[model samples]
Target: MDVTSFWLAGRPATGDETFSVTNPYDGRVVGEVAVPTEAQVEEAVAAADAVRAQAAALPVHVRAEALAHVSRRLAERSEEIARLITAENGKPLLWARAEVNRAVSVFRFAAEEARRWSPTTQRLDTDPGGAGRLAYVSRVPKGPVLGIAPFNFPLNLTAHKVAPAIAVGAPIVVKPAPATPLSALVLGEILAETDLPAGMVSVLPVPNDRAPALVDDPRLPVVSFTGSVPVGWAIRERAPRKHVTLELGGNAAAVVLADADLDWAATRIGLFSNYQAGQSCIAVQRVYVDRGVYEAFVPKLVEAVGSLVTGDPWDGATQVGPLVSTDAAERVESWVNEAVAAGAKVLTGGTRDGAVYAPTVLADVPADAKVLREEVFGPVLVVQPVDGVDEAFAQVNDSSFGLQAGVFTRSLDVAFRAHRELNVGGVIIGDVPSYRADQMPYGGVKDSGVGREGLHSAMSDYTEEKVMVLTGIDL
Candidate 1:
């Protein structure tokens, strides 16, 4: 395979040293990528800082057209990009295709939001003290952004950071996860093709150890991170003065109320629990079914999990594939063993084969097992029986990570109650916690992190409001 160049200030550049990205499935070297030198990283940062004013002053149409161009190009080259995602990230082909499509929509939405950007006017003459005054308020870019992306949805997650920064006129420096940086480099290549300013974007595969200096740099005032709980919080604490947004994963729960369609619930839970090899932050890690339906639901869920096909990711029909590495699979296997030792019974699938762990289910789990209390980050899920809705909601809220939760129910009142009672970023009423639209408001409370994602929401996160008061306005 040819060497993949990192994007430095919208141009491809190679560094002194290179690293190989190997396929997690078979341990074959898929491609080699250049690691950015410290000097190269500094140059990229300085360029972004120097072009901050120019990037912030670009015309809305210029930003919109640039974003639209990227969206169109991604749609045109969907298959090639999807294959690359599967090759390095070990996700199945179908899901890789879905990720590319989601990224396409993300840029499209950013373009629309750029066109719709406008200031709001409010009259400040309600009382005689503020006669003939009007306040015009607009949200402006805070500063240059530092986006740190994770490996699970490498393409789309990076897009979530870069697209919004571009739409809102914020120059951004991206550090893609070292494990899966090829897709992001490809995205940077596409961004380079746009007519936007040169310093608007940079994709650098910086090592994890050297990321703190970027976070602490005052030039980049905003940091957007999506990864594990400890790392996300460490970034925030390290840069307490910067505007930080975290989309950390959680031990997401799926609540199956007694009134839910049991079969549909079982199928969705099974599929999402293991999708993307269960590396997703919102993947279903916990399940709480009403005791009235627990006996009926467990068998169907087991059958659904058993029917899923797992093998090489390049195959078109594979529903599950390897984890990102054998190390990740081993960690998952250890967690499952620990859960079983603590008296949790495996309803199905408690085996590992190299880098792939079988989609496993557990029942009668204690509340404190690592598989139940913490993020398993694997294809393992723990299920428990709840006596009622109150108990189910309580169990879902019990986690320190309150990212998102799924509740299966058909009743309108129960849906409203779930919306009101669940302490999470999003409440999916009829599906699993893994269901996320690229254009909706997303993020979590508590340990799950701060701020929101999606087109308009992320734009707001990258900007702060500025008020201009005109005192000579006539009433």
Candidate 2:
């Protein structure tokens, strides 16, 4: 496949300086693509600005149809996009395919949300004779949104921002992570074929250095970014005037209560925590098992972590793949090593290859260690023993990041306590921390993120509510 350049404003554009997308398994060049310069970023922004009104004016059903078409196209070409994703991102092929399926779900959910946002009405009564007044609510576009998606879950994360923006008649300029832009480019091409107006949406691959020009544009009414905490903070500082939906970093916690079924929780937690090499915002960063089951859970987890097949991402049987780049793998290795040096116990799998780290399990990690505090963004899970549910909640809420958390408990009281005391955005019960439905209200609190990105919730984030009051005695 030729990854040389991409289509911008309905035209193919290439740059002089090219960057190679490497296969992380063996460090081979999968393809080479050109990174857009600041000038090209400006072109994309201008293109989106030019067609904002036309795109926004389309009827709700029309918009829905166009988005549904993209969904269908994505489903039909799922394997191809999955291959591209695995090639560029180094995720297992099965995981990439699953992500493509999730992407389709995002479009479907957004399409449904678009059809539901049509004008609505209500009657209001106030004071004397004011009872004759009428009031109603209507939706208005927030104008062109600048979507900056990260490498992790490239398609779904981008869709979480763009799908909702487009659903609410807002145009978008998407900036995909340079390391994993091919799937987004393919979707951009599919979108261009829809009834969407010219320049309504533009997908441009830009290096990290060029992000400021994309985020700081005044024409962009809202800036939706999904990335690390530092970058999200910087974007907020730079674009203070622009509305932002930042899906930032997270150090998610999973509490395995005493009443929980160790067998069931262990299997599902292993699947979720280790999936995608644990390169997700909701990945299980901290596991707080009760003292009763801590001994039993530790061995079960080590065995489960040992079972993951790590190798070439293209292979269907592969469970874990390399990190997006060698640098990412090395960073994970360093964090794990630092934690071990600081007295953390490595129960199993703390080795690393070029962009590939073994599914590592650490016990008794110090709270101040990078492995416990910062997001590892690799397949590494830290296990700690908690005195009880209260201590579990305390330990979970003791972090600056409050994105999401999970609890495995059969007791309703314990579950409710986790829900109430946990400082994260969503607290899952009987499931791992890595669960996210496309239609649910999804986002973070604190430094994790701001705003939300599900179906209806995201639509609301991309739109403004206007109330129109009419008098019965207007004449």
Candidate 3:
């Protein structure tokens, strides 16, 4: 089989060492990708640093057109890209297709945003001393960006980093997760089709160990990372003087109130908890149910989880697939076993075979169990009954992760209260926490990490404001 080309300075290149990407379900080799050597990495960085000024000075129309071209090409090749995603990452075709569609929208949003992104004028005539003075403020790139993306939702998350950087006219170098580099390599292919500067984009499948040096490099002043909590925080600490944005881990919860549509809540929670093999940062991990409907909701949730088909990712009927590796499955198995030994009752599933762990539901989980307190990045859900709205809200807030939460209530007042009290970044009323719009400010607080994603929000993160004062201007 042919080795996939890594993008260096918007062109295809190869290195001395290469690694194979395999399917998690069958362990079949999906493809091989070249790992960039030290010299190659330096060259990519040098190219981006050398072109920073030109990249930032690019006309808005140029950036918009390049982004639009990528968007159109993504739509045209969506199916092939989805297949590649499944082959390398073990994501089901249904979810993989959704990921590609989201990427399609991200680039389009970036294009639209680039077209109308203009400077704002503030008149400084409010005070007599500042009369006839005008201040024009515009956002400019901090410098070339180092975007480190995770394996789950590889294409869309990479798009989240790349699209925003392009929209703001910032040169970007993307370091895709080693497990699923194919989807991102294909994105570089689409980017190469554009008329943008060669140094504007580079996708390097650099090994995880080598990425820290890239993060610490002085040439790249902006770093945007989306991955595990420990790694994201470490990158931020390593580059304290740089502009860093971290979108880290989450143990998202869904609150079921007495008045919520119990059937709707059960269905959404069951699916989202196991979606993408529960690899997403906001994949439902915790469930706090009102005691009034706790018993009723438990059965419905179990049935919903049991109904999902899990197998080969390529199968259109398969909804849940394997974790990225058998090691991940083993870790989840250990966590589940620990919870069970601590007196947690398995309501539905508590089994694993090879790389795939069954969609699991646990009731009466102890407060101190790792599955409940930490981000369980697997297909496991822990349910605990709360007495009332106060307890429910409190349970949701009793965690280090404040990424997002779902409150399934029809009452406007309760929804408002959830929004006000839930310590998460975004509260979803009548839905699951996995819901995210590509154009909205999406991020978390506390241990979940800082900074926001989404086209417009990320553009702001990648750039800083530069104000020009016009003295003695006639107002």
Candidate 1 Cα lDDT to native? 0.94
Off by more than 4 A, model 1? none
Would you give me the overall lDDT of model 2?
0.85
Clashing pairs in 2: none
Error of 1 at 322 (Å): 0.6
For candidate 3, the TM-score is 0.99
Error of 3 at 373 (Å): 0.6
Tens-place lDDT per residue, model 1, 1-475, is 6789999999999999999998899999988999999999999999999999999899999999999999999999999999989988999998999999999999999999999988899998898878999999999999999999999999999999999999999999999999999999999999999998888899999899989989988999999999999999999999999999999979999999889999999999999999998999999999999999999999999999989998889899999999999999999999889878989899888999999999999987877889999999999988889999999999999989999999999988988999999999999999999999988999999999999999999999999999999998887
State TM-scores per candidate: 0.99, 0.96, 0.99
TM-score of 1: 0.99
Q: Provide the lDDT at 166 for model 2.
A: 79
lDDT of 2 by residue, 130-167 (tens): 67777778888788998899998888888888788779
